[model samples]
Target: MTVLVPGIEGRSACTEERLLIVGLGLIGGSLAAALRSSGFNGQIVACDPNADEVALGKEMGLIDSGGTELAELLENVSMAVLAVPVLAMESVMKTLAGSLSAAAPNVVITDVGSTKATVRECAEAVFGCVPSNMVLGHPIAGSEKSGVSAANPSLYLNHKVILTPEPDVLLDALVRVKTLWQACGAEVLQMSVERHDQVLARTSHLPHLLAFSLVDTLARQDERLDIFRYAAGGFRDFTRIAGSDPVMWRDIFIANRDAVLSSLDDFEAGLARLRQAIECGDSDALIATFDRASHARHYFDTLLNKTSYQAEYHMQPHGKVTYRVRPGGQAQGRLRVPGDKSMSHRSIMLGALAEGVTEVKGFLEGEDSLATLQAFREMGVAIEGPHQGRVTIHGVGMHGLKPPAGPLYVGNSGTAMRLFAGLLAGQAFDSELTGDESLTKRPMGRVADPLRLMGVAIDTAEGGRPPLKIHGGAALKGIDYDMPMASAQVKSCLLLAGMYAEGETRVREPAPTRDHTERMLNGFGYPVSREGDTCWLQGGGKLTAGTIDVPSDISSATFFLVAAAITPGADITLEHVGINPTRIGVINILTLMGADLTLENEREVGGEPVADIRIRYAPLNGIDIPVEQVPLAIDEFPALFIAAANARGTTRLRGAEELRVKESDRIQAMADGLATLGVEHTVVEDGIDIIGNGNDQVPSYGGGRIDSLGDHRIAMAFAIAALRAGDDIIIEDCANVATSFPDFVALVQRIGMSINVGGDNV
Candidate 1:
């Protein structure tokens, strides 16, 4: 097996083999460090434009001879690996070609670039003759941070390295390159450069571009300063990508313009159709759309969990597991969902308040969901679940929730704490809300003030934090309140309380947030009306409980959506997705960007829409996203950011500043990840701005380490980012991703995105 030889005088055997890596960024630096930690005894020569990085590489013992000059570094190296930004790849490759010509030791040359076609073309054009020993490599790994200081030796272990070679390229050289990566603790795959570009455009480039553009657009909006103040979890999640590096992302967009632009077109079309559906109030059409999308989501979820449950469990006899039924003995088909904390809270709270017996199938059984269920139960609502994934909620009528016995413990769900505050405010109940340390630290005053205005009494810790003592049982009077900022949770809470108010409770916002509450309330026969930025929920309205079937969460579907879009020959079906218009911004945006997305099997589950989504590899293009769409797609920003990075042209996003106050500062996390991958981006107060030209621009994941900041969205978003990076991207504190999508990594890998665990190499 051929091994990379660094700082060796002449062609040597295995004992003297070494590899020289230039630029001690996330990618180059990570390779050097990983090689040593993996017990590669051969010498490692490292070079970087930054003297500090060179010195640090030496100090970290990642290389034997570290310097700033390529000529000096290449003199004794057998193979040279360029792990730099996409814009810098050509220059580095040219330098390597010159060095190879001088030494002429049959040395192999390779580069780590996110996009391959352009880089390969540039290499061939610049060198005049492509070397048979040359290969293009991309390792899908990284965190949301950059620089040599963050480098770890184990970064590349058990990660995927994609190698794209020309038709005439020597098989031996390909095997050699593969062997070298394997030695550094990586799993290798092969693909064509064109295929890589197209797939990445949808999965990585387009998402990043949209995120950067979204932040830029929001930051420039007149009402941004005010809107950001009121931003909450959903908004923060939608705009988190606004914090990425400007220059690097700009380069990526321009480099892969064709594919990105195409994706943008498709995404825009989906958004337009959704907007029209909402404007027309075509419930049937809207429900149909949502149904198809929702079913698709379920299919995706099943695919994601295929490895978890043994075949026997799925193929069990019908009577093997005891089934719970109501008094009538009418058994509904068993539908089980993984512990989706967000959907669980929504399902329990909404189901309890509906008019009739609302049977919930596949309710999440995590601590967070139990907290919500327990709280509802204390308020005279019977919740039978945490068994067989079926939750039976005895409807309490719109205004029938009785006063609870004691304070409600919300556990660790910020969602439960905030949403319950609103639900209780509308009822004649005296309730106190409490939670864990992390949840308590989050702000609650936003919901408290709105509820108070609607005639509810609430006392909380300073700054409107949790541990709230609520004095209810007061007659709520409807009041028109303009939301100070954009927040779906706060808006939803007020809307819920407004359902029992004396008159029409009106809520106006400078910017729109998710409207699931409004949509679901309407579905339950509540007369909720919307005009422009205002939503009116008529009080004293009775909610009729119909069979309400929840679709698979779109947020959960994002991992597979991107995986199918990015990994070639990967066409997976995501079934039973919730296609609620307010939650489909990612689908809308990606479709507008020209992704080859299709919806099928559209139908209604209960009152919600469900559908199957089929997304294939397609070209993507960049677009200027409107600020209004931000609130609609807030939960999907992480996946959207990956799409933007692969898009073409300058994709601008605006009116999003809520990214700062999430479980962690998502903006900062995204920025840190992009920088590690050598992608240039601009961080702004409200959002990020990305410039793209669709040329040769891929970033190396070398120099730095990234921190997830304890945010699940951030962790998953960065994991997707790693799929297209050249160097191993190490994500620290990634356990938090389980909070949302528990099996994100496994799901993506099953669809063919290269990923691994407990290792540094991609």
Candidate 2:
């Protein structure tokens, strides 16, 4: 028996074609809401098994009518949309098929599932219909959250809707689905179900699976309890997807088992090769692999909207004091580094240069990075962050950044400021750049002076402070700039400005900096030449649209490396980490300190080197840190400090004055904090010397209090130090850890480290 739920009686006559949507979760409710908002005058009835969800959808007017029973609702609908779990789709389709057979004018069916082939097959078997009328559709839209409560009407606006229709499917039915999707402000694309699954397995499914598996494994480990104490921005991002709906992912994994399995196998193979290379200490193999990966990331950056994507952070506290290094412990399972941060930043920036709206998945949306996006918005970039760290950048073209009416505020990101300075220096309009307190204190002279030499006028406070005012519209000429410091930011700035210079721009560094800028420029159809330690870029090169696959960041992989190196009997594997020569100094330094590190599965990702590293905790001996490695391991020193403190001999670090200008006075902060823990360490103007004896003999400070100084790195560093302390360590003003790693505490706790909030113990 069929029952009809009448439309609003007097408001408007109900169109005979009604669409019934099941599951009033974010995607389901959003579909209904978008349909109505997009001028669909047709009736939209929605149903959810949960009574409260249906009630809320109805109350919120997101649906014309809502209910808990699918059979009752299916009776009157002309078409049905299944927006539930992939595993649940078969049963729901079966119910719809039965109801459609009971009525006349058989209902057209469609589904919004992430994986297509399985869903299409399931639909065919369950509905007993030629697959044409049952369209397997994925809106490629969502957030990290779930439930109807999180639904919003604008979810699909200008997003992609991929349709996988079988050969026997009705063309008319496909057109209707496409039209409906278009009405909801989405562009439609057609692909074979198999291809869709394969591509997404690498681009989407694998990343999520890695994040979940990593967190799950950590949570089940005895060592996980201590992760919260030392986790930083990288771990938070790599494991963020762990917080997603477990049932949903479990279903996705089951449905796309074969493809997911294949992808994992490929990843495993790649990781294994890297492990072999590291074990043999093959520098050539290591450098080649890293170079390839670095190049690929740079190429991928040009296709992304750099301004829209932001970095994220997490912080946690642990009760345990004193870090222990034990040999042969169970290894942390292999982890693919988090989605590339450098690529994430460049994706949003370059995506903004695209002709149409560029949709991006795997974009990081952490707080400190979001500040960069906001700054871009202030500069006239049209960018939006809709649930799940995803972003859409409406590009304005390569030379389209409009001069900001006021100062552009970049918060706590040295990467953003330095790169943007180069881009802005070549622009035609004047702009002022500012930042949060931490950012303001960072050194800008390295980048500023070079741009000034290129005819760009930049005015800063004493010592090239923040609130920098750039006077643009000047005719610039390239210069043969010799880099005094091995700083990537400075080098990148000059190269970025060179893009608009009058002649070839040459930059020579005594030691190499990260070559992301050079590799990316080449990928963008620019002629960028690298000879020894010098890189040259010419002014006139056209950048075209291309697909990019970003490799994992090694900087982000350092935490796991440290974790495995310092935790006794622990072995950990990190997969697909970018081992660019400029960034591999950390690995080199740690290796010199007697850490047992192995690289495996060496391969190229978009021209950069990538591999999996397997590390085992071993008896470590400290050594003198070379001046050349300082710039290479600048961002990694705090962790290095922790490692040094736990090693067997004196560790001397010199030629690292750059630390004084970071988020906090990193060197000073680390020195003071170490002193508080009763560790003997000397702080020089340019470096620090730590004396270690491979024993946890240091007594705790009576107060058990440590200050973060509002620096994320400092906070995370001290927390790791707490592992080796005699008593509970209380880190005060530790909130800034959210700038990079927000899930630090939870991930660590899951592994077995006892961490608590607002207390002296744990």
Candidate 3:
């Protein structure tokens, strides 16, 4: 069945296949043209009622054959594309079913119909049942022009093609359809059949309807001729779609009646508000509306261009971010970083799980915490504001969560995805958790394996990575689990699941991890007790709504602390930083290294200890790291490694195997960066050993290019290392620093650090 379909630019589609395209119009003809141009060598047989269009398609070499006869093309045809008008789809489907049933029993049928619900129903009526090979799709791309002459081979390039494949659709058929669209350079996306219909009705049908109505109304005016003659570009642009095929639009309106009407009602209500504003001369209302629209438009453009400020800001070619830092600058400032990220995430999750509304202050507005907030909103929680570090969560109670429409995408937050696995495991509906590239590469097995022991069915990607798909309603039973590693994320995940399991759940960590989850649970009125290294909680306990005030993150403050310690004449103060007893390994280790650090104005805030930390520059002396402090400062090791590189003697660290599984291998990452900077270091499987000349010796820490490997902590650590660098240090892929510290560059500049950030456009 293979046939050479001639194309433009001396190209030809070379796919050894056959396709029957019914309707030689814009959509069908363009698809045929695009397929050929995309090098899909296939037999393309086109059918149309109009003889002229058939002749033009053949003349254009867009098809191997063109005719009015449908049965002739049905033979040996494995797939058919029905691209006719909406109201004519049923009739076409009926004809195909009756004719192709005998000739090609396995032919896969698909349509480029804008509305899918009616087409699916029409298909069911005509064929007695919509066959499993039938896939419904719509290409969200077109022009006002119609007919074969308007066909363009590049029409679908970079456009969206949505497939509304039913659950029963054959997997092979769906893949084939997706492949064909992709061959034409269209980005194929999937959605439910009903969702497709509703989305198109609002985004497409109603807009066209408005265009036609506006044009028609203007045409009927008394001064119509003058209005048309003097109309500006805005008027013409707004009503451009009014020039589209009238019959096709008319059928679309009738087919998608309810959804279009609903959208129209909403639009009319908005219009009425605008009308009232004009009549009342409410300048404030008019300005507010325009401002909101303008702001939204700009935000959409940013998303479309993948240049949003919060995420992926400073992306470069090949997905790398380069940071240039000048050496020998002291850091001296009095400021606080964002709120503790761990506490911010728990505030949203616990608030959403509680029985009533919960108010939280000092929420980290960083991308990681915001990702968790967005995930809760996706699950039907009414959340308001992280406005200036304040968030209000309308709790849905422990069992009151609606299933998310799709997987919860917790971007760059391993903590969010890990904890959510346990929280979602007890739900009545299934849920899948996904994350950014960095998180997807990190290990999820630690959490998944333990949750499986609790009788939850969880599936991980290859090599124990995400997206983690957790099946719902497992009749989970509490287990006395001993953690293989000292990870707070894994411990929190199990503890959250314990809240819904039968009987009591206890988790024992070999070493102490962060107790934020345990303490936060207690704050939410859920009883949790800690005895030594084991934390236990009872099942069927409800979390009560409460206020949370998150202190500035000590992890973020670590960069500044190290910056001040390594640079001479440096005196910096960090205010309102969390100094949770179990999480102050950074302070303890720095003190042990003989850093000039002091904790001032220490007090308790929202059940967590907070303090103002002031650090003065002092010559550091490296020592063998106490293995007991590894778990306490596991996340801060990257920054600590920077301090060790500037210390007076050899710094040996061991028994910190957990550092290998973070956003990046912190041990290896620091080792590689230190090597590039001409620092002496030894990398082992568990820890790193570094020999330093100390700050007074003008140590041999010459700067060279270092790759951060998309690790935020590694990037910031190197940025701080520039203080002791003999030359300019260049760090790559530092954009991810925004995940925890969005204002790192600005704050560092305010203190005497010289940093230059370069993005893709730069």
Best by TM-score: 3
- Over 639-706, each residue of candidate 3 has an lDDT whose tens digit, in order, gives 99999989989999999888888888889889999999988999889998999868564744999888
Q: Is candidate 2 or candidate 3 better by lDDT?
A: 3
RMSD of each candidate relative to the true structure: 27.4, 20.5, 7.5
TM-score of candidate 2 on Cα atoms, chains taken together:
0.55
Computed on alpha carbons, the lDDT of every model, listed in order, comes to 0.68, 0.72, 0.86
TM-score for each predicted model, relative to the true structure: 0.52, 0.55, 0.74
What is the per-residue lDDT of model 1 for residues 1-762, given as tens digits with 9 covering 90 to 100?
122333222122322455878778877888877767666778888888889888888888877777888876766566678777788777887777666666546677788878787688778777776667788888766644578888877788877888988887766567667777776778888888888888788877777777777777878899999878987887778666655556666777877889889888877887798899799985534544554354334323322443111111222121111111111011111122253355568777877888767777756554456557666665666555446567777677777677765677765577788888887876666788987556677888888887888778899998888898888788888889888888888878888788778988888987766666777677778878999989987787787765545567787777567645543344667777777666777788878877778888888765567678888756567777677778777767766766666566656666667766666666667777667656566778877765532322343233245666656676666666554455545666554344455455546555445555542232
lDDT of 1: 0.68
Supply every candidate's count of residue pairs whose N, Cα or C atoms clash at under 3 angstroms: 142, 78, 8
Candidate 2 residue-wise lDDT, 670-757, digit = tens = 8887777667788899999998747533422222566778777776666655545567666766555555655555444543455565
Name the 10 consecutive residues with the lowest summed lDDT in model 2: 305-314
Q: After best superposition, candidate 1 residue 645: deviation in angstroms?
A: 2.7
Stretches > 4 Å off in candidate 2: 1-337, 354-362, 384-394, 696-703, 757-762
Candidate 3 backbone clash number:
8
